[model samples]
Target: MNTVYIGLGANLNAPEAQLRNALDALSKSQELTLAQVSSFYASKPMGPQDQPDYVNAVAKLTTQLSAIDVLDLLQQIELQHGRVRKAERWGPRTLDLDILLYNDAQIATQRLTVPHYGLCEREFVVFPLLEIAPKLTLPGGQALADIAASLPHNGLTAISQYDEAASLA
Candidate 1:
């Protein structure tokens, strides 16, 4: 099984519930084993200020599926939660699930990018990632804790812990 970290974010349609429901979906997948999950976080949107602040968190899972397959699964989960793709970047969405890392492998393809292109720079992504895996090092050798220390929180705030039972219920 390959260990993977997924970044979850949503700013619309009850954002926090969207994330929790997504987590429940992931846990129900037969090929994926839900592992550690960071506390939920709220942060300002990365692009347009007109959008609502996002609820974000990082999830760790072990999966037998390939990286691309995992990406497909995440996208499917996003879709089920009412995500809509548009031409604009960083626009508000009902759900966004990204594969932040895949078994320490560096990957680049038309469909996806591992270590997520914005992973180190986004406080919502980096800080919650640190909360779950404090000593993690990027595939390229950068220390996650160091990255967290260097990156500003950028108005990110912890909202609540992940409650698996409540989410699944």
Candidate 2:
């Protein structure tokens, strides 16, 4: 089984509820087993400050599926929760699920990238990732905690703690 990390975020229509629902949906997937979840964080919109603030969290899972399969599954969950891909990059949305890492695999494809290219740069992704997998080492051998500490993350704040056992079950 491959241990994967996923980032979840939403800023529109009961953001917190959307995140929780996403977690529940992921937990129901037979191909993936939700193992751990980070505390929810409230963050300012990164690309467009004009949009509403976002609620973000990260989940650690063990999956028997390939990278492409995981990506497809995530998209399915997003659609189920009313996610629409607009022309705007990093625009507001009902739900966003990103595969952050996959068992230290280094992948660069048109559809996805493992150890997500933007992982080190975004506090919203890194902080919660650290919470769930602090000892995780990226493909380049950088620890998640060290990477998070090196970045500028003054805007990320934890608003709610998620219980892994309760949320996954």
Candidate 3:
């Protein structure tokens, strides 16, 4: 099984509920075993700050599924949660699931890229990812904490505490 880290976020509707439901769905997937999740954070919207603040978190998992399979599953979860791709970049949504890392594999495919292209650029992703996998290193050899420390002051903050007990239940 490969250890994969996925980034989840949403600004529309019940953001926390969407994240919880998505995690629950992932936990029950045939090839995925939900591992750890960082605390949910409310971060200012990235692209256009006009949108609502997003609730974001990072999830670590062990999966037997291939990268493409995992991507497909994530997309399905987004669809189930009412995510729409028609909006402008970083627009508000019901849920957003991004594959942050898939083992140490370096892959650049038409549909996906391992070690997501924007992982290093977003404070929302870096902070929560560091919380869950402090020592984790990306394919670029940078530690999670190192990357997070390098991010500019972008107004990212841990708004909602991750309900660890409820998530595990």
In terms of TM-score, the best-performing candidate is 1
Residue 124, model 3, lDDT: 84
**TM-score of predicted structure 2:** 0.94
For model 1, residues 73-145, the per-residue Cα lDDT tens digits are: 9999999999999999999999999999999999999999998999999999999999999999999999999
Give the winner by lDDT.
Answer: 1
- lDDT, candidate 2, residue 13? 96
Clashing pairs in 3: none
Global lDDT of each candidate: 0.94, 0.90, 0.88
In the order shown, what is each candidate's alpha-carbon RMSD? 0.7, 1.5, 1.5
User: What TM-score, to 2 decimals, does candidate 3 have?
Assistant: 0.93
Give the alpha carbon lDDT tens digit for every residue of 46-87 in model 2. 787899999999999899999999999999999999999999
- Deviation in Å, model 2, residue 149 alpha carbon: 1.7
Ordered list by TM-score, greatest first: 1, 2, 3
**TM-score of model 1 vs. true structure:** 0.98
Instruction: For each candidate, give its TM-score against the true structure.
Output: 0.98, 0.94, 0.93
The parts of candidate 2 lying over 4 Å away from their true place are 164-169
